[model samples]
Target: MQIRDLPYTDPGDPDVRSGPRFLIWLGRNQIRGQLKSLSWGLLHQCSIAGLPLVIGFAVQAVVDRSGNRLALSGGLIAVLGVLIAVGDTMLHRTAITNWITAAARVQQLLARKTAELGSALTRQVAAGEVVAVSTGDVEKIGWFVEALSRFAAAAVALVIICVGLVVYLPSLGVLVALAMPVLALGVLPFLPRATRRADFQREKAGKATELASDTVAGLRVLRGIGGEELFLGRYRRASQEVRKAAVRSAQMWSLISAIQVLLPGVLLISLVTYGAALARDGKIDVGQLVTVYSAATLLLFPLRHVEEIAMAYSFSRPSAQRAVRVLSLSRVARPSTVDAAPTGDLYDPATGLMAPEGLFTAVVCGDPDEAGRLADRLGGHAQPAVSQEGAVEEGATDHEVPSVLLGGVPLDELELDAARTAVLVQDKDPVLLSGTLRELLDVPSSGRVTAEDALSAAQCDDVLNALAQASVDSGGDPMDTRITERGRSLSGGQRQRLALARSLVTDPEALVLDEPTSAVDSHTEARVAAGIKALRKNRTTVAFASSPLLLDLADRVALVHRGTVVAVGTHRELLRGEPRYRAVVTRETDDEIPAPAPPGKDEAIHAIDTIEEIEERA
Candidate 1:
């Protein structure tokens, strides 16, 4: 984005500067939209310049007191007032629009970056910091951009006023001009202190926000364990720190504000003292003396923005810094140096795994987290960690996948849309967006598949019935019923079922599902397992699950331990041959009791419960 075109808000950026490069980075990210906003904003600032000038000219004319000239000055004064008012309104509106859009664009960029980074993002940065950047920091960066435009217009106006006063009033103007910079910039001395305090306040604020988000996200578990008050107390202490920081910040601002008022006030008095002395000595005209003071008085208005710009920059710098951290993350694997997409089955040579063309497969991972990470790598949600040496591991790649071949081409090598069409990872905790049944299921872009078919496959006939019942109770069609945020309105099983159903409707060629049946009761899960197996018979489906029922249905299963596929076989074959695999999959014995204490079993810390517990009459 050539930010130069949007002169007012667009801070002119050097090619590479740590502090301001971030703003330029944003510009490059959304060059076209910002270029348009910049074009409109400069026009706005140009209009704003008229405000101070009009005031200066009007005061000058009043001091002159000539009949025709006075009337002409009066008319100019009226026009100037109208122009400043109109300009302020329009310029502010345009600049604000640019600010909002820029923030939104940056948000989108961060989201896309997060998606690309996927599991790597968690490893690279704190989850809270990521949340803070996306939610709070992006807007501050946008604010700084918007402030740039306003400061530019005010700076120009200040310069024009000083030059005009010098031209019109000579020596008196000299004193006024000299005083203008000193007064306008007098707030600088207090800035360092203010910035430090403001930064402290912002840090406290971010910590508070992160704490609150964590508390809310884990509210269910927190309440269960009686940890609510502990977090609440921590938050309270953090808030108190924030309050203290805020008071310190406000104190420093009060000092800066005082200087803003006092420095110029001092200058105005000094200018009047000198101008009045000259007038008394008949060295300067009374009218000129009056004009000088008036101009000096007008100086205060523009100076306010100088202070404003400084403060805005103070807040935005840290925000920009945070945003920069997020934007700086590059995909580990770079796309191949070729335009043509590959044509063949996707082969993870490390694991001797081939996602053969258009076929359903199941990955029975022992570790759920490892399973999730592997799914991300396979579906192109993550750039594979590069490892080139004597040793290599499964599901890791140093190069981007080719795009054209669907799975044949690396998903990352293809254009975003093409890759997404070929592979869709339905997260185990599929987010059920708050909406009606119809809108939730309606994947508008590809409407080829019907809701009935997807619902059948997902075994969501019961979910639809429940929704319809809820709707009827609430006086609306079940299809139009509202789903609450996080789908708290629905049970875990219901939400998962709905999410699964929604994914089924899209029917992408490669569908990666993680523990898709973990929430639903075994009976419902059995139906879903059977249904998904039948419906996704031809499509390339990889179900990341350890459920015995789901495992039985898969053509084959890979037992992933740590980050590698340690075992893969039919259920019975693995059970009979792989000792570790059998222990993990069938820990429950004939009586449903887990294996009796194996001495030196420090690794199995968790108490494994099974049908044996119930059978023992406990």
Candidate 2:
């Protein structure tokens, strides 16, 4: 496909066996573009190489003092100049096309992989590493890909120049040919060291990037805990490490550049001195001496391309390797045997938790972490076995069959799309993508609920007002106002309510919500809980929450202690009969003993309750 047809409808599956292999695969896929670039590069470099020859002919004509010969030489020089301008311009255009297309293809592939893996990708790879791969690493790989053809064209032109010089002036030509190879190959020994230093720099930079990403994501929480300075210091150290590594890498590349310059200068000096001596002794004419000098000087241009090729490879190899590492990752592959989506109660065998169909079931976990894990399992998202270093361990497998089942059939046995349609899980930390408020809520849905209805049910009228006020200067509708990335521009409660509205719009068969109202105050939580119950009426719903405001509205509440359900009953029934369940839901600890209150403490508590009751009645 051409560059204009970018963002391929499908960036074909990449060969991810190794870094070099991945690069080779990329090259093979874009062979047509590479060849086009190579052709243009050849025209450009060949035209440049022909310049010294034309200059020599002009010099010879001047020496002969023939007007006819001088005119012919000048005409030839003009022709070569035109060819040079045309070739160079086209070469640049084609080369840039190749670079952009290659990078775009890789980005498309990464995006596809990310969609397929979902949240599991971050669990298996560092967020920073993925960012590095898609951004900086992608550019490096593209640089190497585009450089390959140009390097080939330069090498070919160098060969042609050496051959032409040998035939035209053998004495100097022999020296030129011999020294050119040394100039080209002189920096080979230092490449390994340079590559290592570059790799080190890239690693440090990636770590720093990951740290920065994490810091920004949690900046609000850090400030709340007064730990922002602590993290800033850590990031400062990481940034310094990156700077030091970069300096080391730069020092090596600088040394190589010096060698390239020094060797070529020496060759030019020797050729000029020797050729001048020959001309003085009348061994060769002045025009022949001029040709040798010009040829030696022009050769340096192509030799610089040789140095560029080395530098590109040194930087891109590691980048390609990192890209391959991310591409090679696979999620827990489950066999798909069932064709149709199953319907019935959702069951998690591992936790012995069941959510009966057509009911609102509230789950209260003694530990919040366990609640998140249980929520994942209930939705067929069993955590894969990943190492501390964020890699899948050898022999790791996400059960042969899913631990979660629907209608007595394992969820993993059904097609992925079917399983997702059957159950939708909104995690504790749901992300809101940047877009208009209307677009944010526009997802695949049963169409039972409209966006307006969902927004009202989620008590998002205040959010709407905020968005409208924020967009008043732009003269845009509230629904059209844009959200910042991850909805960071909104308050935490606003983001949560918006996410809930999106999920409600989907109207899935089974909905699992984890801490959906955690960010809201008690008053808002009460309305949200009632709205969810009213909206999800006669549908299967499971909520992993501890708030009594939410639990009081549940049709049935399950108390999960130590990863297993210990009690299942109505909210009031459990609160009165099960002390363990009450302790969990109320967040009460045994460490505190009841003590006599100060005079009027009870009166103060009664006064606050009276105010709340008055507000509720109003």
Candidate 3:
């Protein structure tokens, strides 16, 4: 495929069985490109190898002083030169095309897998590892694929040179032929050591990369906790380990490179030395000696490719394995193999937490992990790691956490598109892509809610105003304002509000929000809860939170403890009756500082006059 025609019309299904198998699959999918590259590479290498023969003829013609010999030799030289130029140019063109196309294909596959897995990807694979695989690993895979075709052509050329030498100068040919194989095979023993070191280097590098990614993502938190230096030290140690591994790997490969050069040099010396003797004995003429010597020199070119191909494979093997690891991850929770979205109640058999249709339900789980897992199952995303037996603890009163049921049908049974559209789950740490506000809010919508309505309902007026003020353009419109990645430029409260607004815009049948208002103030939290209740009117909305304001707004509040819902009642009833519920939900409020005494009459008059002056100035 041409570079411009990239992203293949049909990238074809990739084989995720194994790393090597996946590489083979990539090759098979691009067989036509590979063949074209191979043919061009063969012609190019063969043309170079044929050069010695042409030069030999030219040398013989000069020696003979025969009629029109110079002209004939000159014509032959021109023709060979043309073939050499054309072959080299086309070979390079095709090789590059193959490399780019292969990389593009791998990148496309990675992107598709990322989209399919969604947030589950980071849970299954390290964020740094995923970043490394999608970026650096892709290039390594493509490098190997491009090199394989050229290696094949080089092998063919090496054989042709060996055969030609033996046919024309039998004595010298035998030595050179045997020596060529030795030159190619001599480095095989060192390869294992090199490959092992490379693997070590890659492992260390991945860890270091992951550490760096985590450090950057949590820089603000680290600073807040005065742990920035601690994380920096950890990253420094990781980087140092990676450096040591890379040096060791380089040392091994350097030895192999030395061997590659040394063996080929020895072979060249042998051919020259032996060919001289044959010429002296008249068994081979001077021209034949020149041809054999020149062919030996040319053979070095292809011999280098042997080392190159070995190195490419060594590096790419691990990279391909990393890519395969990511691609092989399939959602363990299969929907009920059905195509339609089920209706009615959303039930988690394992936790026995049921949110009946058309109600705003709040689940308060002390353990965040348990709460997150329950949210996943409620959204039909429980991974297979939660074993069937783990569905409900053995002998527990709760029913087995089999596939959650939406209405009466298994949630996992519905088609992915239908199921995803039917139920939307907003994670606690939602991402805001780098784009205009309009694009950020433009999600699959039922057209029942507009962006303005969603934003207002989510108590995002201040967020919109903040974004508008941050806009580079003079229009200062939030819809036109650009948000930085993950909304890093925005405050924590602003990002949370914006995420809620985006979720509201989707207008799904049911929405599951995890700690949707944890970052907002008490007043904003209450407003958001009330807004959500009003907007989602008569639709199922489950908010996993322990905030009193949010829980108070829920039509029904469920207390989840030790992985199961222990109690269910109205927010006020739960607070009055359930001590655990009151303690968990009111813990934040209890820590809050008491209100200060009201200002004195003189101070109040001064504050009022100051406010009036400020209003007049505005």
Candidate 4:
């Protein structure tokens, strides 16, 4: 594949069984590319090997005073030089192509897996490990795969040189052949130890990487809790552990490298000594002695490749394993045998909460985890089934498979794409991907709700103005302003509002929002609730929240206690009748019911508020 064909048209199905198997699969997929690399590599090495023989013949011609033979040898030398130059150039080109294609293929697989696994990917694999696998691991894997063809070509060239030497001069050839194998095999005994050290080092490095990534992601929280130094010290120790492991791995590899060099030098020295004695005994000519010495020295080139291939394998094996582990994650929502998304009440039997059609329902859960899980299920992202043994391995949690149904059909049984299109679940901590404000809110483009409408409903005018001021394009609409990754440059409330606006633009048939207004001020939250309720009139909208203002605006509110909906009523009715419901919605403990702050003398005590005024206008 050429550079232009990168991001492969078809990366082909990968073999995720084992690291070695995956590497083999990569080779098999690019057989033509591998052949091209192999052919060029062989031509290059063959020309190099032939050079010594040509030079030896030229020397003999000079010694015998044969000018015609000398001219012929010179012509041959020129041809060999051209051949070497072209062969080496083409070999490098093909090798690079193979490397790029291999890396691209692996990266594509990783991207696909990340999309398939979605938010649950971090639960299955550390975010840092995923980053490491996609970046560093991909290159290592590609390097080893690309090295295979050249290593094989070198081995073939070595064999050809040995066979030719044996035919031309048996005594020296036998010595060199036996010694070459010994040189290649010399490092084998040390490889297992080196590989073990390398694996240990890689494992420690992954841990360090994970720690660093977690620390960076939570830096704001760490600073807030005055734990920056604690995490920094933790990361420092982790980084040191990684360094020590790497040093140990390097020591083992250094020993192997030394052996690779030492054994080849010893072989060359022994061959030179043996060939010199033969020349002294008149069994070999001066030219033949020179040829033997040159060939033995040239043999060192291919010998080094053996060590390289081994080293490549040692480093890439663990990387491949990590990639395979991530690729092997089973998606919670598979393309089902059934192809339709059911219509009607979204029911989660596990939570005993049912959100019916064309209504604004609010679910209040004391435990946020239960609320999040319920929200996930309502949107057809069911947790995977865990058997008794699996549950034990995963830790103590309810192993029962959550049953969620849309209309009457089980959500998991419906096709994944259809389910997603029908239901949208905005998480409590929704992410705003880096892009222009317009692009961020252009998700799926349901065409029922426009960007302006959604932004207004989500109370994002301040956010839009702030982003506009941050934009490089001063004259453009505020919606054209760019948001940084995860909207990090924006305040927490701004990010939350922007994410809510994006979700609003999607306008799914069933919208499940979890704490969509938690970060905003009370007035903003009240406006958001009123606006959403008005815009989503005659549509299904289930919001999980505890704020009284948000719950007060819902058509119906359900109090979820210990993972089950225990009370369902109008917000006011539930507030007055149910003490647990009142406690949760008001965020009050039994020991304290704090008195409302006294209004200033100038403030008017109106019977109704701004939220009511907005509702009256709507």
Candidate 5:
């Protein structure tokens, strides 16, 4: 496809069997563009090669003192120059277009794969590796793709020059033909070493990048724990390692480059020296000597292209392999053939937990970690559980784990889009992408709730006020305030509320929220809980929280202990009837017994006291 047509509507299914195969697949897909680039490149190189011959004829004409031959040679020079200019310009344009379009296609494929895998992609691949592949590796792969046509044109031009010399003056022509191969092949022996060093450097760089990303993401937490220096030291070591690897890699490539320059220079010097002897011996004239010298000199240019092709492949082969690894990752072996979308209660057979349709359910787990896992499982993206010995737990493999079902159909059995539309799970820490507030909130939604209504239901008046104040100097609207990456500029509580508002706007059939108010104060948490209950009235919602403020608002509460639901009833009933549930929710000890207050009275008093403390602090 042409550059203008890029950003392919579909990048098409890639052959990811191996790195070489993947590179070949990319080439085959862009054959039209490659061929166009090749044609221009051939014209450009051929015109350059023709210049030396035309100049040789001009020299001959001057020696013969023939005005007609001189004039014709001058005309040929002008024509060749024009062809050179046009061919070079178009060749460059087409080659660059090939490069940019190839990179775009790879990026599009990476983005599509990322979307398909979702959170599981990061779990399978290192965040640093993903960053490296999508950014630096993409350019390397594109370089090789664009270099292919140029290299081919250069090779063909070299062949033509050699053949012309052999036919015109066999003595020097044979030497040139034989030595060209030597100059070209001399660098091959060093390529493997250079390639290894390059791969090592890339690996080191990826680790360093990943470390830096993680360090920056947790900089606040690291400072709070007085461990920022420790991470900084580790990162410093990683950076040093990357530097060392890069230097070693550069040293090897420098050796190859030296050989490329040295061999060609030697050949040129030999040809000029030998041709001068032929002219002195009366075997060939001054014009023939000049032609021999010029051909040898011009041959150096195409020889460099040969080295470039080698270098390009060395760098890009590993990059293509990395890309292949990432693209090969599949959340499922195959797409679900079942087109029917299921609806009803969300049920996890593994946990024996059922969140009935059109009801608000709260799950209380003795282990908060388990609650998070349950949330993922309910959304059909469950990760394998690791045993204490660091091995994957049996029967918890991705393919083996029991699927969560809705209306008797397995969630994983339905098309991905259909399943995602039916259920939405917001984990404890939902990231806020960097953009204006309006852009951040403009997600796919059911249109049942407006952005303003969702924001109000999320009790985001303070957040709006803060954003407006921040944007006042810029004279922009409150909704136009730009958030920092991952919403790092906002307080944790503000970020949580905004994420909640976004989720509310989506208005999914089943919404699962994990500790949505974990970062907020009791007063705000209470309002958020009440708002959620009111807004989600007659909709299916599952909230995994232990706060009495949130639990009291649940239509029903399920108590989970040791990975299975043990009790299901109203919050107050479970609190009174199940000791384990009470201990988990209240942080009470089994040995402690106290006089009970009136039913639901304790919760009301607790909520009132928490609100009073929050107001006093404010």
Candidate 6:
């Protein structure tokens, strides 16, 4: 949030929009700031032109009256100097603040847009491109928008100075006017090449960043396979590519700089030579000659900058285009029947998986991949939307299913907050936040359950004791002890149990947990299952687990084969009915358990109880 720490927002001209167009966008949004900046720029430009004129007038006056008018002209010249100094300082401050705030606002807008699109943002664009756009491109865009105001005012002042000279000394004025167009338009020849080089540089930079990110994420696997050097080589190649692209961009920019500097030098010589001739011919007065020379001299300082600005524009335009592209991405999550009236218990009619109200459902996917995919769907992580995302690789061919629903409604149909409330998925990764035990259980919000309550329910009394115990490692009570990044300090089971406990605290309507006790031993896994069962009570709970202990605890188990549910029954039932289900559930022990019972027994008994209850009421 600190402005000083942020990357430079004013990308100095590598911005994509034309200077005028950028001003138009800024004027549309921050009209007040734009106008204020414009006002300051105008004043600053006026000071430059005015100072020269005042000097020209004072010199003429001294020559004309010998010394009689000297005092008045000298005082007027002093006033002009003071105004120029004061105006220049104030305008400089105003221009800087204007750019800083404008860049900040554009960054805010990009962040807001990213949040709206969420995961879909990357799916709509290359992930590397999104990273580059948010960082580099957004800043470039704001830079151009800020620079446009001053550029516009400077341009107008240049024109005004040219016209004034034409009237006072026509010959000198016309030559100076001719130089401005050549400076502005002559650079057109080199801009295309410059833009092409800029695009290449940006593209290479994105690749380098992507390679770096991917390598870091896969360091563990790479180290295991002894492929660290292979990846390092890849990154090295990417870095080299980036270096080459940068050199090309710099070369083109250098060429543009040469033209900006060299051409203006040529123009200055011609103007000075022509002006002196007019002065020697006695056609133009000495005062006019001084004014003409001053304008031409001052003109080059601004005019040469035009070439630098042209190259800056070329450098920044691609970044702006990328940023604009990212901002333009549409959000996913289409409107559905769930929006009309939320269907209570979770339902997936397509896959024939249903957890009716107040049921302890265990899914037994014949394929481990299918089980995990179904878990994500049940958890509302995957759903049909205007946009689609690539599968989050969970290892080995276990891809995400197309549709997962709650009640009759597709989980994706619900808004994000609503979906989180309805179904909570504890991803395989045990996310350990940096906070006290109470805060970790809290999941960051109001209405959070107390740490003591969630811990007791999770059977974390021992965990708190361990945390509270003082040893060579000492920080605070286990309950108060902060978890390290990714909870690297904690054991795998500790991390998993803590994550499961956090989800339990949310107490969502339907909970979908993926191997909540995978890291724990048999005894701990059994305890977690019992604790989870006791805590769920009336709420629907769906778990994707192959552990026999957790499987035995399920009221009913469904077998998911491939991307669809193959069978629905208790854990024992699936073992007997489906070989694949039995094989997955008892991979360690090939022996299978018999079916527990037919689902009809519970249904038939429920019907009888309903009839008897009605009779009792009558």
The candidate that achieves the highest lDDT relative to the unseen native structure: 5
Tens-digit lDDT string for candidate 4 (564-609): 7899998876765577876776666876543443666223323332
The segments of candidate 3 whose C-alpha lies over 4 angstroms from its true place after superposition are 333-336, 385-401, 588-618
Candidate 1 C-alpha lDDT tens digits along 247-335: 99999998899878888878877887888889899897666676667667766776787998899888888887777666666454455
User: For model 3, what is the error of residue 69's alpha carbon versus the real structure, in angstroms, after optimal superposition?
Assistant: 2.6
Model 5 TM: 0.93
Q: Per-residue CA lDDT of candidate 6, range 274-298, in tens?
A: 7778779988778877887887777
Q: lDDT of each structure?
A: 0.69, 0.85, 0.84, 0.83, 0.86, 0.68
How far residue 197's Cα lies from its native spot in candidate 2, in Å, is: 1.4
The sequence of per-residue lDDT tens digits that candidate 3 reaches over residues 72-177 is 7788878878988998899888888888999999999888777666767777688999999988899999999999889989999998888988897788889899
Clashing pairs in 2: none
Name the regions of candidate 5 deviating beyond 4 angstroms: 383-399, 473-476, 593-618
For residues 481-543, write the lDDT of model 2, one tens digit per residue.
Answer: 999999988999999999999999998889999999999998999999999999999889999
What's the number of clashes in each of the models? 8, 0, 7, 0, 0, 12
Show the lowest summed lDDT stretch of 10 residues, model 6: 387-396
Q: Which candidate is the best by TM-score?
A: 5
Give the CA lDDT, 0 to 100, for residue 116 in model 4.
54
The model with the greater TM-score, 2 or 3, is 3
By TM-score rank, best first, the candidates go 5, 4, 3, 2, 1, 6
| TM-score, one value per model | 0.81, 0.89, 0.90, 0.91, 0.93, 0.80
Model 3 TM-score relative to the real fold? 0.90
Prediction RMSDs, each to the true structure = 7.0, 5.4, 7.6, 5.1, 4.3, 8.2
- Scored against the true structure, residue 565 in model 4 reaches a CA lDDT of 89
